[model samples]
Target: MKYQDQLKRTLEFENTPTRIVSLVPSQTELLVDLGLESLIVGVTKFCIHPASLRKNKTVVGGTKQVHFDKIKNLNPDIILCNKEENTKEMILELEKIAPVHLSDIYNLDDALKLIDLYGKLFSVEKKSEALVSSLENKYKDFRHYIKDQEKLKVAYFIWKNPWMVAANTTFIDAMLRLNSFDNYFGNLERYPEVDLNTIKEDLDVILLSSEPYPFKSADIKELRSRFLRTKVVLVDGEFFSWYGSRLDYAFAYFKTLHQDLSD
Candidate 1:
């Protein structure tokens, strides 16, 4: 059978792959949600949804790096990747071992397309269908709930040290728009480092993401002291950036975020 990935790459498999190596954390969680946990032979260190998953699966490495020999020994029937999560160089090396299915998701539609394709690829159409349906319904309800919300100007901080924000052309930015938050740095492409002092726009909220940098409460307190008018809060990075079965909860999380801001 043949399957086309989000990157327009085609992968042919003799049959549904039983031994899979998942390079992307969100996709790995999706596979587990699809009842393919037993089939996954290797996963990344970041795949922490099940929390106990790594105890059983081989730790292949991180998003940017991997242990080629460990993956080779597992002999994955197929390897899964994502354009934003995995590098092109990594994909090339992984291809030497087995067929690689790469996903490129920017918005909710793209995420759903991935889930639907996964169903066809693994012969789990019903499971994927139900999951997609659940997410769509939650998204619809959330949209309705936020229809009356005032669009707030937001600066969502993803990385600290040098200071970086998710701008245009990222899943995190898409999620921000879905929540009706106008990204202060939406003009730029990809994650860009910025000096918050340079931004003249009056931001109603300054969001600190809890990942990649692990922003602590002290950071929020420091920012709150600097910008007394703006609301500073730490948000779960997974819900905003992760595009998979994890999306089933993003809608609810977004709604709560909006409610908290209102309060």
Candidate 2:
């Protein structure tokens, strides 16, 4: 069978892939949720969602730095990756070992498409369809809930030190828009670095993500004092950024975040 990935790469498989290696954490969790657990022989160290898989599955290393030897020993029939998470050089290298399926997600629709593609690739179409339907229903409900609410101008910070943020062309920005948050940095292109002093005044809310930096309550306090005009809050990065099965609960989480802020 021949399949085309989101990156337009051609993946040729003899049959449904039995030995699977997932390099992206979110996609690894999606494969498990799709009931392909036994087939996933290896995963990156960051694929820690199911928890049990971390103990059982062979660790192939992190998103950007994969141990090719470990993956080679697993003998994966299909290796899953994401363009944003894994490097192109690594994808080219993994191609030598097995068929690589690369996913490129920008918005909610693209995420759903990736889920649908995985279902066909793994022969779990029924499960995938149900999951997609459920996600769509939840999103519809969320859209209705936020229909009358004011769109809060938000600045979502993903990293510190150099101070980077989720720009217009990223999945995080798309999720923000879906949840009725107006991204203040939407005009910017990719994940761009900026000075905190320049952006503190333009936002209604300053969201600090839990991953890639692990922003906490203490960090929020410091920022809140400095950026007094903006409401500083800590958000679960997975809900906003993990474009996979995690989305099933993302809308609910977004609702809770709004309720808490209103209180």
lDDT of 1 by residue, 1-263 (tens): 98899888888989899999999999999999999999999999999979999999999899999999999999989999998789999999999999999999999999999999999999999999999999989988988988899999998898987999999999999999998889988999999999978865388999999988899999999889888889999999999999999999888888788888999
Query: Clash pairs of candidate 2?
Result: none
Ten contiguous residues minimizing lDDT sum, candidate 1: 195-204
lDDT of 1 at 71: 97
Model 2's alpha-carbon lDDT is 0.92
How large is the C-alpha RMSD of every model relative to the true structure?
A: 0.9, 0.9
Segments of candidate 2 deviating more than 4 angstroms = none
Lowest summed lDDT over 10 consecutive residues: which window, candidate 2?
194-203
Scored against the true structure, residue 242 in model 1 reaches a CA lDDT of 91
